[model samples]
Target: MVHYLYLHGFASSPQSAKAQDLGDRFSRLNLSLNIPDLNQGDFSHLTLTRQIQQVSTLFPPGEAVRLIGSSFGGLTSAWLGEKYPQVERLVLLAPAFGFLEHWLPQIGEVQLRQWQQENYQAVYHYGEKRSLPLHYGFISDVRQYCELQLTRPVPTLILHGIEDRVIPIQASRDYQRDRPWVQLVELDSDHSLGNVLPEIGLAIQSFFSLK
Candidate 1:
């Protein structure tokens, strides 16, 4: 039995369009699809480590598992790939790496400090809530984890839009540089890839069919 774990992006939830689409596909195929809601409780104070741990506990062992993560969830999934050898394949869609190293400068210390203080949660149309306390330390931890802990190579599929403004397509290109097992696919769309879902779905189905 093939089990799938779907992780949503930052400030996103299991109710996103991609997650729902994948869930429908898995239902048709009679495979198990797990999309855990990661935004409950005091998420504002929760660290990335805690978040990943909570997500990890949802999986059942002794079955072939695959992970598909979007945006920040992609980073989480990559960390899981490094930690869990049993995961068969990892799919990252518009993943962000070195987020703090790059995006922090634009946020500025004053706004960041204010954001931390307020602990605000803003809801978006996609059913995700942007939580406060966006820790710079989380970025540092992710960078170190990706650099040192990610020594083992896992079969990975990376799907990104060529015109993604939020995460940029170059990050995916740069990620594929040293990772030979990674397969990169570029779509002619923006960050959402709204026009290319069918193609993305087909590619994922094809990839899973192969050895």
Candidate 2:
């Protein structure tokens, strides 16, 4: 059996609009789309490693998996595909590649150092609709998963927005550049990708059908 799973982005939940929308689409086709809560109700101690482990537990023995992820979750999906043979196909929406390099500058030098010293940073959790103190360990744990090590030939499809200021479209470009197993599709929307769900849904149907 092929398990279809959706992993929501950072500071988000299974109830995110995109996740729900995709879930509904899958339901209409008589398929189950399991959207796991990556935060595990503990936003303060979140890390990429934990997300990977959590999702890995869902993969049944001798079963294949098709992963669909957004942003941070997309990054996690990539790593999952790299580590697990069960993950045969991936659909990534605005994945955050070169994460720390992009985020540290946005957090700024002063705040970054302060977060390290303070051991926590007040990050707004979109899923919770409030701010939570995310541990600095999130950074250290992520550094362990280098993008260069993601050489797995898992069939992947990346849908990124040209106007995604949150995570530049160039990130996806850089990721798919040397990877022949990956396909990149550019959209006119932004990181939210709310307006292009139909297109994404259609692309997913076609991609999954071809192979």
Candidate 3:
């Protein structure tokens, strides 16, 4: 059986709206979807490296795995797909490629400096009322995996929103350039893509034709 792993974005959890919706939809088709909490209960030390390690341990080294990632998770998928030949295919939703470069400016140099000095940064989570602590280590750690590569052409599909301010659609467009293996679908939505999830689900079904 092909394992379908769903990786959520930063500050998001396994119970994220997309993950839960997809889990139900996939289940109806008799597919098993694995949604792991990337933060592992300690958001302070979370990093791309640790996320990859967690996925590595969950999945056997040489087994076929299908990936569906969003935003930061999309970035994680890029690294995973490159390193692990077992990733048979991928579906990225508004992947956060080039995030580090854009992030510093969004936060401002002063804020970034403060975060680095304090070792933690507070950001409001989607479902939580209060802001959460995301350590500076998370930002520093992703720099290593910022560069994305696909070692071999695995069947890949990317869904990005044109109006996405968080991670610009142009990032996906630029990333897809010269990469014949990737097929990017531009949707009329925002960064979350929550409004058009049904359409996204249909696209996923058509892309993989999961049997």
lDDT of 3 by residue, 1-211 (tens): 6788999998888888889989998999998899998978787688999998888677765679899999999988888888888898999999988988766788999999999999989887764556888889888887766464444687789999999999999999988987899999999999999899999999998888864
Better of 1 and 3 by TM-score: 3
Clashes of each: 0, 0, 0
Candidate 2 pairs with clashing backbones: none
The residue-by-residue lDDT of candidate 1 on 1-211, one tens digit each, is 6678888876777888888888888778777689887665444444467667987786677667788888888878888888777777988888776555556677778876765565542323245343344444444445455444555688999999999878889888888888898899998987777688778777778878732
**Predicted structure 2, TM vs. truth:** 0.98
Across 158-209, the per-residue lDDT of candidate 2 in tens digits comes to: 9999999989999999999999999999999999999999999999988888
lDDT at 113 for candidate 2? 92
Off by over 4 Å in 1: 113-144
Report the number of the highest-lDDT candidate. 2
Q: How much is the lDDT of residue 139 in candidate 1? A: 45
